[model samples]
Structure formats: C-alpha cells, structure tokens
Target: MDDLPRRPINKEREVDVNLQVASLLGTNGQWDVTKLIHLFPENEVTRILHMQVGNVHDRDVWAYSPHGSYTVKSGYTLATKLKEAEAVRDASEFVEVLELKRLIWKVPTIPKIHIERLNTRGLELDTCCRICKAAGESIEHALFNCTMAQEAWNQRSLTDLLTAYLKFMPDETIPFAQRKAIPWILWAIWKNINMLLYADTQESITIQIVHGMNEEEKKWVPPLPGYVKCNIHSNWRNAKLHSGVDYIIRDQSGNVLHHARDALTFSPNRVTSELSCLVWTLEIGFYFKDIIEAVKKPNDWPLFRALLQLISSLCARFRSVAFEVESSASNQIAREIAKSVLCDGHFQSYLAFGGPAWLHQRILREAAPISS
Candidate 1:
C-alpha cells in the first residue's frame, strides 16, 4: 500500500468484456447468431449429446481415424491418407467404407499375421494355417496364400467385380483404400474366418459392399407436398474466428429454387456459425414471401437452449412456416460451398440458379447407384 493509489475499475470495460463473452441470448438479451460469431461446432455438440445419452456403461472411441482407437502411427497414417485422398477420384467412396480402412490401416492383414500377434500374450492358440497347413494361419495366408481359400478370392464373381471397380480407378496413384469395394467384402470374409478360428460360429456368408452401400443409403430428402425445404451448413476453422456459411432452397418436388453462400465477417464459434446459418437461412426465406411454406433442416439444428425460442418466433410469421429437423442428409452443395468459401476466399451466390456446376454433377452422381 506504500506508494500505490487505488481507484474504481472501469465498469463500462467490464460490461464490454461480458458482452464479448458470446452468449446465446444476444447482448440486449435477444438470440442472434451474427452477434455471437464464436460458438462451438454443431457436430461436436451433437457427438457430446450422443455421448450424454447415458449408457449403462461408458465407452470412449477415437473419432479421428477409422479404427476407433487412436495412435500416433494411425494419426500420421490418417493425415497422409487424407492429404492423398483429396486428389483421388473416388476418395468419397473410401470414406464410406470404415471397415475397409480398419482392415487396411497399418496393413493389419495377412502378411503381418494378426493371429500370431494375438497369441503373443501366450494364449497358446495354434499358429498353423487352418486351410493350407503349410504356414502359420495369418490373414493373408488364410485369405489368399492358402491353397484352399485361394479359390474364394479367385471366384469369378469377386474377380469380375474387382476388375469392374478398378477399371474406374488408377492403379498407381490412388491409395488402395480408394481402389475397390472388394476390400470391404474381403474384410467381412476375414472377420468371419476369425470368428470360426476363435469364436464358435458356423455359417460362411458373403456381403457385397457395393450392394450394401445402396441398401443402407441415407441421402437428402425432398419436401412434402405444399412445402419448401432448405439445407444449411457452416464451417469454422480451429483456433480462428472466421467462419463460412451456406444454404440451399428447394421446392417440395425437389427443384432448386435458390442458393447462397458466403464467408462470415466475424468468427462466431462453430456452434454459433451453424446457428447463424440457420437464422440466416430463415431470414432469406422471409424474402421468398407467400410462396415459401415450410423449411426443413438437418436434425442437429437445435443444440443450444436458445434456438427453440428463436424457432418459436418464426412460427408466428406465416402459416405452416416451421423449423423442421430430420436425420436425412441434404444435398452436399451447402457444405461444398462453405468449404470453398473457407479455402478459396470466394463469395458464392445464386438467384434463380440451379446451383454450381460441380453440384449438378454431384447431383447426377447421387442419382446414380451407390454414393459413399
């Protein structure tokens, strides 16, 4: 206290800091996404909510890689795979096949001999090949090298499918994960072989990866009769405030009505970015006037407590105007546009336009068989 003078702290500065703290309830106590340009990403919040679903037992799985178990080697391998995959023609297809990645990552397969490694703890399980008996029972040996199982891989249907799938892929440049759908089938087969070797099971069945993709597809949904649907997407870079926002509007019958995408002027956090995109999307809908009926967004739309009230406000504005959420995957156009705005620094806008040319091709591809 000897040579120090005490004065009151600046109350205005305190209030300013509090306001900048980024609240769902706006500065004046209103919900506004643009005002709080910094929020957590929606997917992150969704995963958290999913975890909070309260399991009888808690389980943790690594999300960044396909194996659900993270390691330094796996991370490095995944980073390289992602970098290389960005250039691959069918890279999207590879992502759809997690089983394939789990099988191939770090080459967890035949030549490496997973069975011997399993017995390293001294389980005393026989290492001899169940099929050929010439060598140890390893993944590769059981699948291909073994004289008996060799015919399974050599089956005309499997070979023909592999040949047809590979005809569209480059042999040298593309990573093996992106090469063919055959690996998923092979991995399924490998898993069954292990079940027979270790677990007590009987049937040897085949699963076609290509056919399964079509069977379990969850693509964008069209609006119901007398309604208009819109998809929204947002992206925020880690450790940075700048974010990208995108939205696409379509009629009930699935005709594109309008679309717009832009980079945010401020870095509202990821959750905030998505909320802002949702609000911005609705605001744009207010422009469509009488013709606009209802809006449908991704099921993960309302994570924050404030969004429900904000959605309530919109319901009073027009007849049948409601914020509907669904698990259906929307057209990837908004996501593509948002990423483009982030990477290329371009503001994309379309009025009375079908969408970007790239999206048209993607739409066509989605219309075709099997989208990964």
Candidate 2:
C-alpha cells in the first residue's frame, strides 16, 4: 500500500482483492519490484550481509520468486543448461581394502612387495617373507601363496571360508555380518604369522586363534521440521588396519534426504574419519543448497583443531550452526547402517528415500503399545 502511487492504488487494490476472481495466476503475471524495494529491500540486505566470497552458495536458484515457488518450468530450464558452477578442492581419497582399486591409500599390511616398492626409493630394508624366508615378499605371496600363511589358514575352521572368499567377490549374497569375518580373520592370520616367526619354539603360540565381535542395539529419533539433521558415525576396525564413516540426512519430519555409509581404508584414524564425516556432510549440503539454520549437535567427539577448521571454511554459507552429539541409545539405526557398509565392503549413497527398513521396524515396535 505504501509503495503504490496515489493514482494506481485502486488497480493495485483491485489486484489484491482478486483473491476470489477467476484468473490464471503467474501465467502472465508481471512482477513489480517497487513493492519489494519499499519493503526494506531484503534482497539487498541479504546481498550486503552475505557479500563475502565463497558464501554466495548459489546464484541460479530464485531466492524468492514472486509466486514463492520453485516452478517446474524454471527447474527444467535450469536443468537443461545446468552446467552448474562447481569447484572441487579435497583431492584426498577414501579407500576400502576389500574393494581394492588403483588408488593412493596405503593398506596396513606390510608385505614384501610393499617393502620392495619402498626399497626402490632407497629405503633399504628386508624384502623377504618373514614366514617362509623363501623369496622376496609380495602382497600376493604374503597373504595368499605363502606356505606359512596357507598353512595357518588351512589349520583354522575358516579355511573353507577363506578359500571361498578368495575365489569369489564379496557382494550382497554374503550376509551383512558374515562379510566382516573374512577381514578380521585375515588380520588374525597376519598377526599370528609375526608371532610365530619371533617367538621361541618352546614358547610358541598354541593353535588358539580367537576373534571377538560386539553387538549394540540403539534407537534413532527424528528431527523437527523446517530444518535439516545429519547423523554421522565412524569406526576403526584395526589400530594398524583401516577406518570408515557413515552419515544420514533428514528433514525436520524425519524423512530421509540422503544417506551414505562407506569404508575409509586409507583414512588416518577413526577420529579423523569421524570429523571428515562432518566436513563431507556440510560440503554436500553446501554443494546443492545454501545453509540457513543449524540445530543442536552432540558434544561427544573431541573438538580437534582440524575438525574446527574444516567446519568454518567449508560451511561458511550459514550465519550460524550448532554441533552436538546425541545419546548412544538414540543412535542405533545410524550405527547399524555404518557397520553394514563396513561388512558389505562398499560405499552406498541414496537420495529422497526412507531410512533402513529393519531400523524403522525396530523403532515402530518400540513405539507400539503393549498388550493390555
């Protein structure tokens, strides 16, 4: 009303009053900017307040359309010409051992070949298999063809399991939990090999090869609407072996927006990978849309300097965000998903989908009323 001139008042007023009028809106509607300028120029304010570099987030999406909707027609147009302006900086790779491919991440196993490879660079050291002492060591020889390694594995109840895994690739056919047994057993075999070589024959380790696994049951809670929530979990299987991370994103209504669970075989450590989870989550969010509001985060993880730096620089799109941790009881679902990826031996990502069905069932069961 204040923005309109005295003469155009009635037409503007008539347009405002056409709430019940039979008219196709937006088809030919002409937007007037004078009204916005008079209304404190929020666009300008947002521009001035967010003028800093790296915070613009996006320029293609309409911040506020006249109709206040992201029209399908516009979306299609954007999609057609959408060579979206993007930049990538983190060149580091997250590696998985079971799904080995050509990559830079080092496996914890120190086979003869690894030593030999290093020796080529002038770091002279023993390049022979510690067990057989028959020839120069190699990843293939140490883990697979070595007489001692094969003998150790052959002695175990898992010999058939190891043989089968070596012959076939790990996939969905393998049970979620069963898949982990292979990796852990291999670690055991490697560890025992070292012991056998160094220890005296009289004090040799008897054939008691044992492995221990722990199970946990926890519940996950939904976030409130109008905001987004990201759940992250991480694990380090062997101190000298590997690490991995998992994360999930949801709207305030608890509907999943995105989810990813993967093994980080190359990751430096559990804490680093856990913190990297936050950085990757924030990076993904910023990659698609601008961050506006943040919610509570648990305080469980140590506030490492690298983690803090990652958040400040990568998540600069927002004015504010909170970091906190939740109770372990409420984190069961996410934990399960992370463990699944580690066992499944792959990285999985999904968008606009529901949470894991088994987890949802457990949640619903707990919420159900007891028999009267």
Candidate 3:
C-alpha cells in the first residue's frame, strides 16, 4: 500500500441562523411568519414535507405572493395540495405498476438475443422480452401474452408458431410456429415498448407486438395491388379511394373549424370487391384529369403533375376496385369519365386528350338517357 497523508483537525463550528436566513432570502427576501403558521398549521406534515423537499428557508419565504406567503390562500384548500400530491404519486406508481406486471408474467423482457441497451437508470440492461415480464419486455412475450398483445394476435390470422402456442403450450424449447417468425416477435416487443413509453397509452402490449409481427409478414409476402388480379374495366370505375382523406374539422375543444382536403381525386371508384386492373387504371387516369381540370391557373399544372405522380406511386400495387364482370354499370361510368376527360374544353385547348373511346361507346350503348 502507498503512504497516505495525515489530516489536520480541530476547526471550530459557527452557528448563525441569521446568515442562513439572509442567504436564502438574498437581498430582496421578505418574511411573513403569520402566513407560514397559517399555511402549515400545527398538525399538518404536508407543509413541512413541502418545505423540506423544496428546500425553502426562512428568507426564501419571499418567493410566495402576499396572499400566498406560505398561508392557506382563498382558492387553494388543503384538499388541493392532497390532490396534487396524489397526482404525483399516482403518476410515479403507474409506471411502477406496469413494471410489476411484467415481473408477474413470464416473458422475455430484455435486450435482443444478441444486442443490449441502457435502461432509464443508465445501467446497461437487456431490452425487454415478452416471455417474462420481469425480464424486460421482449417481442416473444408481447405477441404471446400480456393481455392486450394476446388480443391483437388472437383477433387476426395467426402464424403457424403463434397458432401452435395458442392451441397448447408445448414441451422442450422451440415451438411449431416461431422458427420462421423470431425476428418479427422481437420487433413487435420493441415497438410495443416504444409505444408504451412515449405514446402514453395502456393499449394491449401483446396486440402491439402482434402488429409488429404482421408488419414483418407483410414485408416478406408483399400483397399484390387490387388491380393486379382484378377486371380492369369494372373496379376502376367504382373505386372508394376518396374516403381515405380525413380532413381535420375542429380543434380538440371544438373551438375553431377548418375545411381541408382541397385536393381532387385522380380516380373516384367505390372500391367494390370485384374491380380489375383495367378499371383501376381508368380511375387513375380519370382522377388525374379531374385534378388537372380543377386547377385555376396554367402554372399549377406542374404542381398537379407532381402530386399525381406521387399518388400513382403510392397506389401502384394497391388492390383496385372489383365489380361483377357481367355488370355494365361500372363499364358505363368508366366510359363517361374517360369521355368527359377527352372532351373537357381545357384539355382541347392545351393538354392533348386521349382515353378509351371504344369502351366509352360500349357503355353509352348500354345506358339509359336521363333528362331534367
């Protein structure tokens, strides 16, 4: 061991309550002993605790307003203080309760099988696993258990591993369905943790995890757009894409109202069950024409074209409207929309117009004329 230096001792301690109070009050500090007495009273421990926790000294009494000055103000009762304290305690307890819940459940609640991150306490900890709540929330537990997570999983179509788990808890280590969906399980756990922490919700943690799993499946087996397998002429004319736009109508308290969603549709199909690719394309083209016609100025064309291209890319593989193959109703709508686009005065004067003419004629031949 290395030699250490010895310390000199015997310094006298001084007590100056005035100096302490002066320091707390600073030069501008004031005092109201009567108010402090009134606010604190004789029996209440709350005022003492508040002073201790807030570190308020005699001189610091100036921080309060004249009416407040540590006294019971007119509007604030002891009940108010109790409520505030309860709110604080409840908030703290809420998170603790969730943690306790995880502990009660046997879910993997930690770092991934391979990686780890620091916990809120700054200690290097495993990411949560779903299998054991005490372990930290992980994908496995969230998708399989924890009430809410289980609900989402059960409600939708389950994968083989999940299905096996649902049917019966198996012996040994691996189950029937999990081998193919391990990553998905993990991702769900992580996503649910994030949602729980940041979104301030008590949503089914398991359902969130399952959603993550579904998202993973969606990635592997990307769904084909409706139009890909649909009858092109029917579905496109009856698409229901217009409902997708949900404009904000009012503030949370219903104060001010605003009208949004000014953009016109490129296609206005009702999205029936039987639409085909041809109908889908027709809707797209017709919607595009509508947007172009709605514009008030020539310069807006550039912006409109850019927006049209974006819509096209987003809906590229989306399932288009479906209609009965033998029904001429959808067919006529498609023709009329196309014809209107072709004959629009704006298009004739500037934009070159070309659409399905034969299909339009076919639809007209099959339709009954209407007059006001």
Q: Which candidate number would show the highest lDDT if scored against the true structure?
A: 1
What TM-score does candidate 1 reach?
0.45
Segments in model 3 whose C-alpha atoms lie over 4 Å from true places: 1-110, 113-115, 118-132, 154-193, 204-351, 354-372
Tens-place lDDT per residue, model 1, 138-238, is 65566666654565566524554465674745655555444554665666566656776677563443444455444445576666778877777776784
Could you give candidate 2's per-residue lDDT for residues 36-154 as a string of tens digits? Answer: 24432454433222211121222232422221136666555455333221111232232243125324326565565576666664567676666678676666676667876676556
The ten-residue window of minimal lDDT in model 3 covers 1-10
Candidate 3 backbone clash number: 71
Ten-residue stretch with the least lDDT total in model 2: 291-300
In each prediction, how many residue pairs overlap at the backbone (N, C-alpha, C within less than 3 A)?
A: 13, 8, 71
Per-residue error at 330 for model 2, in Å? 0.6
TM-score of 2: 0.34
| Predicted candidate 3 versus true structure: per-residue lDDT over 81-151, tens digit per residue | 56655766779757667566547454564435324323432345445443344454544566565565565
User: Could you tell me every candidate's TM-score relative to the true structure?
Assistant: 0.45, 0.34, 0.21
From the highest TM-score down, the ranking of the candidates is 1, 2, 3
RMSD of candidates 1 onward, in order: 14.8, 20.4, 26.2
How well does model 1 score by local distance difference test? 0.54
